[model samples]
Target: MTFKLTPKQEAQVSLISSDATHIMAYGGSRSGKTFGFVRAVLIRALAHKSRHAMLRYRFNHIKASIVLDTLPKVMELCFPGVADNCKLDKTDWYYSLPNGSEIWFGGLDDKERTEKILGQEYATLYLNECSQIPYASRNMAITRLAQKTPLRLKAYYDCNPPGMAHWTYRLFVERRDPDRRTPVANPGNFAAIMMNPKDNEANLDPKYLEELQSMSESMRRRFWLGQFADVTDTALWTLELLDQQRIVDGELPDMVRIVVAVDPSGVSGEEDKRSDEVGIVVCGLGNDGRGYILEDLSGRMSPADWGKAVVSAFDRHEADCVVAEENFGGAMVQEIIRSASADSSRKVGGQVPYRPVRASRGKIARAEPIAALFDQQKVSLVGLFPEMEDQLCAMTTAGYVGSRSPDRADAMIWGLASLFPAMTKQNAGPNGARSPVVNLGYKSMKRKRA
Candidate 1:
């Protein structure tokens, strides 16, 4: 069987088709990446048919549906002679070669399952959609393929750019030095084959490309153009939702129970100068059940300086309790605030206490559930803090960490969550104590797309 290669696929295969240790094929969707890599693996396995060869994907089910089901149809067109032998079975996602070279399919869902197949030395390893597998799993799979001898073992990893934030991308794609790494036109040495949608001009449907162009600017940039989307883009929070009438400033309303959120920085003196601003916000719920952010004490300062500032926010707002992100400084942040309150000059009342919650999730994930509350009209922001507002508006689909200015959003999450602890009950620890979901400085969580 002979399948025609798109110009882009042909170029990429030319670079990687040889006696190489590794071949990295990365490109946009429908670039014929999978077919090219699969063809190489199948041909190599046939060359050493007596040995084992396996085609793997993120999961066995996908391998069955995609490779086992679709690949043979394409193979029939490419190699008409072997079309009769290409059979899809329950466990195997490939076919049987006449030379005792049996093509099998496997999934990399868990280490235990993957390890089960590692006992046999594989003549060729085909990793379909390599980006889906976690870095840890991919590395383990590679190490397991230690060759027994002259059988010759080679592996091919196929995927597209904007790979999952998995460690695989950092180690392979990002670290590959084009200058030092000798480029091969075939499967010889470690080579990265680059392909763009336009490169496969002959096969791609014109309507599909035009449809991509018609998408929203953000969507086109991320999905079609293969760019990283911002944390705020498509985020649940939007400027329009933060109704101006809901924003309250200057002084918080009388004792509906106020919460002050603190994001304390551990750095001191000159070191603190370059660090992010330690944010402190005082907020409270109103009679109507809406939330109000009355004061902001956010800026870069030494621990002592920030502690004092936190105390001042508590005193000024007569805050009911202080909620602090305790991941870095932990209990020490509480101690600092307590010590600052005891000082004669400050004498902050009620000890300027710290909740000391430790964060277990990313900034966006933590903020997400809270953002839902606001979206559902369960929480309301009082008088807009423009700086905080700016950060919220700039947040993209990736999360707030990308922008490096999650302070305002972080402070807001902590302040609101303190009053509504039940809001995050699902993520609570074994002891029923909630993880530090919010603090002053916001850290973003990694998100996976379908």
Candidate 2:
């Protein structure tokens, strides 16, 4: 096969071949940035006995998205039989060419693997899906781009552009140093170009473009048009605040109590595909008296599907109980839980414990207190929750301002409220004594005539 580059990819190749120290290829999803960038790295590796590293925010993500998917495609289509000459190291996650060159893949979320990759100097470093990576980790990896090879050392980055506040936007678009918030010493060293689905139409489905056009304005701007979404001035949560409290993978403290909260969006299977997403979030109360968010399983699913997801999260996390929003349809929601528990494959002794919660206040009224916990830095996210964080950042004092519904944020708030009863003291009875849910079967003698 002849190696060909689309105009967008050709632009990237020209920029990368230049003397620029950093190259950013960012834009909409399904663009050719990743393929072009990976092919360039392989070209360099095959040219000399140089070392290259391909990294993403998470090891599993990079493995699935690039190492397993894009890398193989690029090798087979463009490089052809050259892939057969390379030996893949599954243990350390890299490819060893017939020559002395090496290509390593890693996820910054994995501390152990990151240490191993950082030990080696690389002629080239490619940060894939860099929007999800923290600025601090990028700096840490940049220190290792010091291999003494014949090729000029370079670092490549690509992303489905995040908000304007992201480091990529500051460094590549604003030409400002991310940390210092000032002009970079050499502005010419940082270069970036946008590549949207429109530019890669030949490689995409016609229906895909229509799908992108059907999205909300904000969603279309970021994913389809490849524009940097803005952080609203009235948002209660900021990206920096979430990053400050983010706990790296494999570092969660001992959990004292865990609960799964669900907010069903009235979608029951294929019957209603246009309903809002079902918000499912698992939160744990650590022994240190702080909160740790375990997972976000929110999506648009039928009752059976969301119910299964809820029960699955319950069993996987070993949560005390599953709390769901009953305001949608009290009896129907309860029945769904009962049916889901009956059908659960985990084989619970009888049924997973179910609790129904009613929403007496509006979303902002409920989120204000939860946002305060974040403001106080008492809560930490176990990993990145991009969609959940988006909803949170769109919530403000006035209303839910985002294009999509804030169901994920609502579920998170409910989980936190359940874990910290003090956060919702208003729901209690008079004199601050919260009413407890009592199991009626244990009663033999009453309170002894107190």
Candidate 3:
């Protein structure tokens, strides 16, 4: 079998063959970093009799991603027709090669499993998705990189560049001692290389590039361009702030009012060229008077589809009402909600209360109070919502700089405003003056209760 690797993969293979004690292959998604390093590990394991370990943040992730996807493909590509020669121990998650070399797979999240892995010594250590592994666990694993063998003792790390604040950036890219906060001029045995998706274009789907191009600038830089971007000062919200105020499920008191807020996308049909997402967020005012974000059901859907989603969230949470922004579609938005609710398949009987909110101010102006609420510790997230959190963090006082519209953040703001009317009134103007609340003009349409 004839197999040809891309130039970047060839370079990575060469690096792996060298005597670098700590080697890193950082790059964009599908840039062949993992496959290259896996191949290198195989070559080293096959060439010498040594024990090696492959690790990720979680054991299940390794099993699901590498063990099920990449490793088999690597074996087929590198060692053609040699499958029968390898012995895989499913119980222990290790494989024994014909050359008396063994490779073990483990995760850092499991304390017992991590301890067992740390107890053993290894000639080679491959930390897959190293960005997800904490610095403490990484430091602990590095201490075990000692196994008596003819093969050179080395470690390979590969991950799409995370935030610049990550330890990987400080240690390898900046060549700084994380603990001492000092630079190492000669970083003797450490080396790092950046690879972009374009470098290995042949292996990726043609549509993948387009998808990456459509991503937000911050996400594009980190995933498609392979750069460590500082997300702290540039963005209004940080991961630390969100994590600090995050609440576990079922930790909130009984809610006084639960509202599902919607930021409707203008695209009315499925065939519309625009793919703008309809932001639907479920939030509640707890008995303690604190706001708890329950869920984010935002998605790119037509008017009918998003209306159904709003109805579903209303029923699921037994919400008081569905508050929708009427900036895009005035009365039509309410009609869409009614039409979707009237569907027999939905099992929704009678009228669903719909409140239309018109945005009289800019997004940033309306979002300021919400951001203030978060800062004041009046708002808490019930669970992790990566996409929603990303949008939330990307929003700033000036405006949202994310690639897509911050519909999710907008919906969250609306929900909070409904619960805390003071947020819409106090400190709303530029000079700390109260801003007049936009009259919603409460008009109720009579319908039988479901």
Candidate 4:
């Protein structure tokens, strides 16, 4: 394959080759940032005795995303069979080029692997998705960029902008120490460039751009427009809070109860392109006393399709029940779930445990209490859910500014609220008497590994 750089990618390459010791590429998704960065690093790795490291917050992510996918794709497309001549060190997770250059990969979360990688010196250290990586890890990794190689020592960082509060924004964009909040000594040494999806429009599908265009305002700015987020104070949830609460998929606790909450859009799956997306979120109340949001399956789907999705998610998680809003479809949602749930091959329909919830109040009104639990640090998203999280951040004390229906966030709230019944809005009794609310509290935090 003939290699060529898009205008945005060429600009990124020029930035990497600059005098700045700490270079960062950030902005929206699929702007060819990673491809350009990886290609530049691989070029530097061509120098004999050159040492480099590719790293991320988690080992699995680096391996699956960069090591197994991006690296090889770049190698074949740009470097042309350089991969064939290289030997991958499966044990340490790196590639040993025939020219005596070595590129190592490690996850900061894996202490043993991190220690091993950090023990060695490197000419280049590329921190993929630096937003998820802690400042401590970045600092420690920077110390290893001290190898006496022909190439200049440099540290490369990239991420889809998380929020202004993230270390990347503080250090690169604000030119301040991430932890101390003090001014950085040499501001020029830290350089960052924003590369949104639009900058690489020629390489992206029109439909993909349309998808980005349709994202909630916050997400559109962060991922589509490629800008740092400025979450409002009145907003019940901020990106910073969500970042702190994110746990890897392996950290979920044994679930006492799991529910799949469906917020029906009242549109068929095959309906017009402008129809609302059905919100399908799976949430669990952990035995360890934290609320876990397991998945976001929200999308535009027909009644039968969404019904199958609900049953599929229920079967996969062995959820205790299906909690869906009855405001829109009434009995239609129930019948679809029941019908799709039928195993026609066996001539029997599975009796799915269903609970229909009524929305008696506005979205933000019902979501306020659920959002409070997030502030209390009692909610753990079992991995990243960008769309759902974006919707959450769009919600304020007054109203929601995230999406058309804000269905995903609503579904998540319903699933979690069902787990903590006391937090959910209760139907008023005679004389306006409501059910007594239960205190939602936890003693301490504990880690559970899958």
Which candidate wins on TM-score? 4
Off by over 4 Å in 1: 1-3, 50-57, 92-94, 148-151, 163-168, 174-189, 216-223, 226-450
Q: What lDDT score goes with residue 181 in model 2? A: 99
Q: Give the per-residue lDDT digits (tens) of candidate 1, residues 1-450.
A: 336777776776676655667777766556677767667666665566544445444344445545555567556666667756545555533456766575556667646656666656666676765544445556666775665645666777765453223333444555533334533244225667666566665777998777656654544543366443233336555543453124221333344567789876645744566666787888776544556667777877787888777777766665656788888788788888887786433243546555677777777767777777776666655543556755665554575533465676688788877766667764466799766423332111111211
Task: Rank the candidate models, highest lDDT first.
Answer: 2, 4, 3, 1
> Model 2 misses residue 226 by how many Å?
0.8
Cα distance off (Å), candidate 1, residue 101: 0.6
Give lDDT tens digits, candidate 4, residues 1-450. 357788888888888888999999998888888998899888898865788999988787788788888998899898886777899989877899988999999989789999999999999999988767878888899989899967899888998887787789999999999899999999989998888889988878999999888886777887798888886768888776675566753345567677899999867666556887899999988776789898999998878788888888887876767899999979988888778768432122366779899999888889999989987878888876778887888899878876477889989988888887767646444566655423234222322212
- Measured by C-alpha RMSD in angstroms, how accurate is candidate 4? 7.0
Please report how far candidate 2 places residue 280 from its true position, in Å.
7.3
Where is the poorest 10-residue window by lDDT in model 4?
441-450
Better of 3 and 4 by lDDT: 4
- Candidate 2's TM-score: 0.72
Residue 201 accuracy (lDDT) in model 3:
90
Model 2 Cα displacement at 191 (Å)? Answer: 0.5
Evaluation by TM-score, superior candidate among 1 and 4: 4
lDDT of 3 by residue, 1-450 (tens): 488999998888778777678999997878999898888888888888989999987687787678778888999987886667998888988988998899999988789999988899999899988766777878899899999988889999988777677778888988997667699666867888888899989878979987776676656776789887677664656554554456542245667677899988886655665767788999987766688899999887877788888888887877778898988878888888888777423243465877788898888888887878876767888865667877887887667988888888889988888777667853255776655433232222111233
- Which scores greater on lDDT, model 1 or model 2? 2
For candidate 2, the clash count comes to 1
lDDT for 223 (candidate 4): 79
lDDT of 2 by residue, 415-445 (tens): 9888776777645867888754322222111
What TM-score would each prediction reach against the true structure? 0.49, 0.72, 0.69, 0.74
